[model samples]
Target: MDHRSETGHVMFLSPERVFYAGLLGRPRNRSTGSLLIYVGLGGRLMLTCGGRTQADLAIALIPPFVEHTIASDARSSLCFTVEPESVTPAALDLLARRAADQGPALAERICAAYVRLREGGCGPGFTTEELDTIVLGAPLARRRLDLRIAEAVARLNDFSGPAATAADCAAAARLSQSRFLHLFKQQTGTSFRAFRAHKRARHLLHFVNEDLNFAHLAQDIGYPDSTHFCHSIRRFYGLKPGAIFSGSRDLRIYRGAAQAEATAVAALA
Candidate 1:
């Protein structure tokens, strides 16, 4: 492994999606809402989930809300996450099975794409579709969801504002609370509360490169207090709030270009 490759890390973050190429910090159990694909950059990675541990794996896929831990023989890895709501369940399941005993062919392609991304000086402008095509050979099919559920999904992605509640979204969608909750799970394969929690924790990525106080940062991102904030971060990321911040100090972070532009335009409005 080239020593220089391990020194620089970058993260690409968009709404409900993330591509992180960096350190594989100390392994700890984490259950996340997004489907995860981890590829070891230097060599095979070890994976443990569902009472089974697999080694010598070039790639591994973990479904949403499945508690799992991963570690690699190398210093860095390429991790990509997809929001389950954006793809059909069947598509996700097929990928998960393929990754369980995945070989090096597809893994090699993904690693090569990462090299191209780094060498091309690609910034926030990169789209998820582009990433899918480059690495997966094609864009994963999109899920056609109910309009009402889609409306609620849009609100959930805006984690920087007040947390959206089931009641609030149900009312907005002209449905009763119970019915909305049922429909949400049926359509998205996760409960509203669980999805919201993941989004809130994921939103912290936007601040990884910023210097800020933890307590204030917690409040700004819709957490009730710093304790709850720290707990949630650890649950989903396997790292404490302070540790995440400190570790990402030198990492290059980029938000989706369209998202960044939208935020800027809203600010100037």
Candidate 2:
């Protein structure tokens, strides 16, 4: 098999979202908190979930927290991860339709946008709205969350800040813990714990290119220990922490304005 790595791929990162176009390393089961959209760049893609394998797929949309393994015959792919809380049900339904149809039209547009961003000399300052416009033809309608739930969501998404527990967020929102958890699920369409875990895993992308100690990194990200960190990373990304870092070495990452201040290497290209 040809083992030459595809270098110089691009990734755009923003709050509650990520767009990645790069190598699809060895596939393993991964269950992530973000609704996943996978688009093949070359040959057909294969997706296996729930004991069933679907082959010759050009596009697939997998909901959040679904355990699945995906691979592309071409060895690389275009993937977009939409945080469940960010979009309305209607938008998600539209995405589902597109994915179900194996949207050649949508996939072609997304591929063009990727090419534009990669060769256009753009930096990481783009907003999520702009990203949506370029890739999906318009901004995805935002889900209107409750004020209290929105506050809690903000706290959880701010990965650079001190970790906030459910109790902390509940207290800040002035609600009982039970009520808070219930409302969080109702508004976000995910449990508070699952959302937090996904945020922690997503935050790892900010430091993927850096040389950092795993133990300390674990603590920095609020993981109880290195073992938990490794397990969570593997669960979400289907790759070990070390493997993620190594694979991302040649990948150029663009962080939105919110993350640019927290991660200096977001300027890398």
Model 2 residue 186 lDDT score: 93
Every candidate's CA RMSD: 3.1, 3.9
lDDT per residue (tens digit) for residues 1-269 in model 1? 54434556778777756878888788988888999989999878999999899998899888888999899999889988999999988888877766655657778877887887676545666776776776677877789889999989878777445778899999999999999999999999898999889888888888886799999989978899999999999999888988888877767776776567655665676
Residue clash pairs of candidate 2: none
lDDT (Cα, 0-100) at 4 in candidate 1: 34
- Each prediction's TM-score versus the true structure: 0.91, 0.92
Worst 10 residues of 2 by lDDT: 1-10
Among all windows of 10 consecutive residues in model 1, the one with the lowest summed lDDT is: 1-10
Off by over 4 Å in 1: 1-7, 100-102, 265-269
